[model samples]
Target: MKTEAQFENADVNMARRSFLHYAGAGMAALSVLSAASCKKDHSKPQMTTGIDIGATGDLAILNYAYALEQLEAAFYINVAAHMYTGASDDEIALLTDIRDHEVAHREFFKAALGTHAIQALTPNFSSINFSSRASVLGAAKAFEDTGVSAYNGAGYLLKSADYLLLAGKIVSVEARHASYIRDLISPSSFADSTVIDSNGMDKPQSIAQVLAIANGYLTTKVSAINYGYKAY
Candidate 1:
């Protein structure tokens, strides 16, 4: 596979291969992120405020992941705060854990991007019944599953072996999170064919398609120009 790096002609990111395992585990604990002063500078054309995805590359790819993390973090955090009715204690605990992970992911990109990090995204959760535990978990499962597939689909696009490996590491966690939520929705729902293809591979969507599907659920339209994703 001719993987593309996350930035313009950046190195293949082979240098980090030796410690990629270490890097992935530490992804959640990343502090001192670039989010220091960088935030949503101004309102953009889309209902959601985000940076322009400049183009394909490592940084851009990170930004893309950051945006999604922001979305998930925000969603889960909100769910934790309001909490859906009929949610069990175990369900609450799992959702809280998912929230923490997303926060860590969001912060990781912020710290890594420094001045280049994008702004916070406002989610449109109109479609979600925050009052229903079943509805909430189902939607969370979809988002998490979609997130894993998104990263998996994009991983091959990253030429930097290090970034590709990093993506793999993160997506695996996302898959776990997705499975946890799915099982909560219904037993044996985690590995269902609705998400997996005949080849047993996870199905993925283009970012545009993902966002389009997500648009109905979110009130804001998060753009990816900052990450430099050309509409395919």
Candidate 2:
């Protein structure tokens, strides 16, 4: 019953599974590294006032990303603090993990931007009823989806290869979060036409478009002064 072809197929399948497992572990390790490296940077001067996350440069893009991460981290932190009623244990664990990932992402951008990073923003979650699962999950879906699209749209604006690579790594994680949240809201809607286009690509949003949606939940205004930079 053990044919050579069957054995080869089994080996190939095992290899694929192993590769996926290792890749997931690698991303997890990266997240830990990002968070652990967020030590006190006493040497770098902090901005007392919030700066416009704009200008034609990589820093502007990084700050844009940082702003989004701050919003997401704050949202998840609040969700974790006030767990919605009727939330299952699995839901709690997933939300906690998402919160950790967002914190790591926020820290990574802050560390990378150093003194240039914008001030910590105050979120206006007045519209979100955190006590209700529908409200919480709906907000989660919107944030995750918006984040993934923001990164995708902004990736072309990055001139530095390093920044692009870092963005790529983070965007993939965001997309995964979006997919998971989408499925949670409605099973089997993870990769539906709503997010994925006819060309089989995730939809992208301009900075203005994203900020318009994000500002509804943020008390502090985020502006992109001069983001029309030529790609390097």
Q: How much is 106 displaced in model 2, in angstroms?
A: 0.4
**lDDT tens per residue, model 1, 11-48:** 11222332334456334323222242234353343322
| Candidate 1 TM-score over all chains jointly | 0.74
**Can you write out model 2's per-residue Cα lDDT over 130-226, one digit (the tens) per residue?**
9999999999999999999999999998866666777899899999999989899999999999888999999998887888788888888676645
TM-scores, one per candidate: 0.74, 0.77
Q: Count clashing residue pairs in model 2.
A: 0
